[model samples]
Target chain A: MTYYNIDFSLLDKTIKNFRIKPQKILLQFPDGLLGSPLQSVVNFLIERDIEPVLSADPSYGACDLPLNQAKMMGIDHIFHFGHSTFAFPPPSEFKGKISYFPVKVNIEFSWNKILEEIIILGWKTVGLLTTIQHVDKYKFENETINNSNITFVQHKEGQILGCNQDRATKIASSVDGFLVIAGGDFHASPIVVATNRPTLRYDPFNETFKLFDEQFRNKYLSKRYALIEKAKKATNWGVILSAKSGQFPKDKGSRILNMLKRKGLTAIPFIMHNVNLPHLSNFETIDAWIITLCPRLATDDYIRIKKPILTSRELAVVLGDLSWDQFITPKTGEHLLTIEEFE
Target chain B: MTYYNIDFSLLDKTIKNFRIKPQKILLQFPDGLLGSPLQSVVNFLIERDIEPVLSADPSYGACDLPLNQAKMMGIDHIFHFGHSTFAFPPPSEFKGKISYFPVKVNIEFSWNKILEEIIILGWKTVGLLTTIQHVDKYKFENETINNSNITFVQHKEGQILGCNQDRATKIASSVDGFLVIAGGDFHASPIVVATNRPTLRYDPFNETFKLFDEQFRNKYLSKRYALIEKAKKATNWGVILSAKSGQFPKDKGSRILNMLKRKGLTAIPFIMHNVNLPHLSNFETIDAWIITLCPRLATDDYIRIKKPILTSRELAVVLGDLSWDQFITPKTGEHLLTIEEFE
Candidate 1:
């Protein structure tokens, strides 16, 4: 029942600094972090006589803001929990009302052990990148690395979202490797595969750091290549037009459909609010799928839907608009070319 | 996989008659019917090159239109399946866009058995009311009752929604008994209790008919009285402001809060898109709940939430604005007194 730490002082500071006196506020927390702390937050707001509306819908990451629901309820402000602010801009309508309160996760591990491992891996300079949670704590300036041989450089962006790893990729040439101070390989593996940069993932929950290097990248790339190959031969494609707040690019499906049509492939756009294995099974005629959802979904090849699901970028690579090399290792500050580019 | 009958001819007739040449259509089916038939319906529309967006949310009945989702996608029309037309008009904005195609469930029960049962029960004139499924098939004129001892009367409204049984209540005095030609007492018991008339429930699923008379009515009334009595003693109330497409009366929650404040009750409104057992458990201060979602939810006492749940009408009864008698038998062609009326 240990709840993740919410920086109340930071939240209060932000509200005061912004001069926000909210009447009706919408609160959105990632599905995993919604529990006692969420209830306490609601009760706290209620005690202050401020109306708080809790969004019960699933929120995957910071990229998926519940702006539509907030607008419908005519909420004055939104407090998004459990993720960093998106590197990319949100829909223009959500300008002043939204606030990000990424909950900080406490990681209790020996930095000495991490430093020793870094030296053993023969890394002299490392780019420091972490999920939003540990960003405030892991300032490279405070880290007492006694060895003059080691240099730790903080990314210009401060933190990295799984979908937006510009900072890590940008300094890949300057640093020997990137160290991710987040839980799990979910954020780490993608950076390694996308940028071909060696990355180390630190799991706070288990107090372990795993190296995602050549082996992981090769596996991910080979599988992605196989999926692209399968999709290249696909006569019929089902373009996933998710209705979820984060994943849905409103006109992306139509653009993909037109592109597929031009290539002499029959493509049908399937609008789904929540995609599940059985639900996708309904479209029996579809040979392959191009998911226009979370860019991260493309890397999640473990989801056994029995169909080759590719990201829009992968689709472009298979269709020859871009090579696999160009699709991966996107130039620093260059945003991932979503199907929106075609439009 | 067999899908219950979808009257395509009737659908085509309605479309042609209405001159609705929809380029993009939204299709919504009740949660139970969202399988093969839903797929077939989508494929059929796709064959005509009419873009179909299948709503993957829980649709309780015709009242739960996916109008919001439809409007978001800019769909030209919505075809709601598995429920009859809503007894009440939708919000004015959704006037032309939404249509209900209540799928007919073919019941193979013999009408002769029903006629004999009515005669044996000592009823001379009986009003025939049914669900959307059996409405078209059960023709009152075609029922050959040679006995001349019984007369079956069909109300002008013809069908009754489980939530709104105005038609049955309207002609209650005109008939000795009411015969509901549907599967369950979900549509029958309320009618019987409301009208104080003996009603027979014909279960098409099991091909059995059961009489719901004084005993059943008294039992339902007692439980309702007990709930009202419990709510009367409760100091704190949580008015469930549901965000579902159908059940969310947008302005209803604030109005209820005002009403409760006027009555000097400590009431807090909780807005939820979906209410679950655990979510309801969070509001520890609230002693009782007034749910505005699906009218049927108020009657589902079996839900393990361990709190007295009341419908708006029952709330009115407890608060002395309306008597139980008036609450039970609503006037003919009149809608139920939803919580919206208090606004």
Candidate 2:
């Protein structure tokens, strides 16, 4: 029985195709997909004589896999829904254990408004981008538009993550503008800032298209610059390093800590699984914070935190290691450090 | 250098006395002690040529150690402050790595008011109990009172956890009533319920003494009984198994899942590092929840959760495997499963 338009038959087929039998499997879902028929999935597994356990933690993306917890509980196989495989190598121990199932949303999309808006902009060639949920829709619409071109980054066609905008950047030189079919400006704004080109975002949920222009990019950079200025006055800093599967980079954290110490600033490294506002506020003596985990914690959650929180790249700007222009400018190819820098 | 009355010299001496010089150590503090001098501690470690890392996750007690995270970061030493060592044994992998610092509060207490109240109550013999922060005060007051007696449970003198009340229960036959010198009723209420005796809690922060009587016990149990009745009608259950250092019990969780299945109820085991309202609300299909982690989650956080949540013992009552009287009665000595069952 399918609920919330999630196709369970695909999951069943995928499990049946596996070579070894999975007696116990861990199920992970993003917050948006939690309303799906969970009991039905539990019953289905029970009928097959397989035990299913749900991960009751906030799963941000494919990078936030609870592999350690799964390993501790002896759950070798994991089925992560709502996102595809992240563009990063898994830890050595959890290489083949994780299976990503991009829960594709089979919903109707009205492309008339976005297409007209794109045509009105007088763009000859346009790059198409979307998230995993709307990749099938993106593919179907890719064939109908003659000016549209879609590129594959890693696994899916025309899919881009919040941190990785390679699909839009790879075809930036060829396309005049870009059209992103996704939920909101969260995915589209990065493309606009990275490519420095006109980008139109079609929110399938709200059925509206909005353009991210040069004005939006300037505002985003100005906010980041203000935070960097605030961080310069901080004498003590808390460097937040994530404990998620792919987010934890101990070496990078150590380098940042060493840099801050050289500048005569008291820096403390914090290892956390969830970096929420409450957890950050616990360090009362920390004048500022430098989050080495998700870049969105600096960009999106800045207002929620009282102290000035900056990303690693932004911290580089504060320490005179990098210029503001170089920090915002888009780079070519899938760089190894860009995954952590952007995220 | 001293902030919030935390003695740093003790920590310094303890580190210097260790035979193995630690190059890197993880520092963990509970939320109540986060406001203490953190940068001073960081500076102290830096002066010794050692790197210090702070754990930003919510630390509930000594049981909430981040051993796995520390191991992953290659930090072999951990100094857990604000609470003493937990009674449970550490995981085999992290046997000798953890060190506990009680962070004793050096605040003055006016025990005259509490002593007068106890005298008016006409209790000839009294058993003393307090937490790590107030254990020194408990010992000092024990020497002055003619009828006061203190008992040791595992580590500290006159220490009682929210889940474990053995300090009071061990000397229950010798004392007419119990006097707990702590901040709040969190550590005192369990003693009142477990022993079913007259208990007085002295809030050192406010310097007030309040007695927990039969009326208070009845009110607490009535609320729990209401939730258990509400949970009996639930067809779908979310069994939460914690991933904290000492809270994770996979065997007990499996037994609960099996019992639920035998009773024809759909039960899904949830493995969580932090069990909060937002995380529990993500499972929309679950009609009720059974948390096998901390007992306080069911008692303290029930009002915040919309659905009924029962502890393992309460779940036992719902399943008719345990009577309500047996669930509340105090057991003798240190039982193997009592730690898990109470927590």
Q: DockQ winner among the candidates?
A: 2
Worst 10 residues of 2 chain B by lDDT: B146-155
Q: What is candidate 2's lDDT per residue for A208-269, written digit by digit as tens?
A: 88889889878977888898998989998999888776678777788888889898888888
Report the lDDT tens digits of candidate 1 across residue range B108-135: 6577788879879899989988887777
Which candidate gets the maximum TM-score versus the true structure?
2
Query: What DockQ would candidate 2 receive versus the native complex?
Result: 0.61
Residues A1-343, candidate 1: write the lDDT tens digits.
Answer: 2347887777666666656677777888775566566766776677767787767566668776766566667788888888777656444344446778878666555677778888888999888887777777765454556544688887664487766677776777788888887777777876776567688877767779899997888887788888888778888777777655556676777888888889988776666555654556555667888777666665674366777888777788878998877765666654342323223
lDDT of 2 at B32: 68
In candidate 2, how many Å is residue A133 off?
0.6
User: Candidate 2 clashing pairs?
Assistant: A294-A343, A295-A343, B295-B343
Q: Alpha carbon lDDT of residue B227, candidate 1?
A: 85
Comparing only chain B with the true structure, the TM-scores of all models are: 0.85, 0.87
As a whole number from 0 to 100, the lDDT of residue B237 in candidate 1 is: 78
Q: TM-score of the candidate numbered 1?
A: 0.75
* All candidates: interface RMSD: 4.1, 1.8
lDDT per residue as tens, model 2, B182-238: 887788877776666789888878788889977887888888888888888999898
- lDDT for B279 (candidate 2): 66
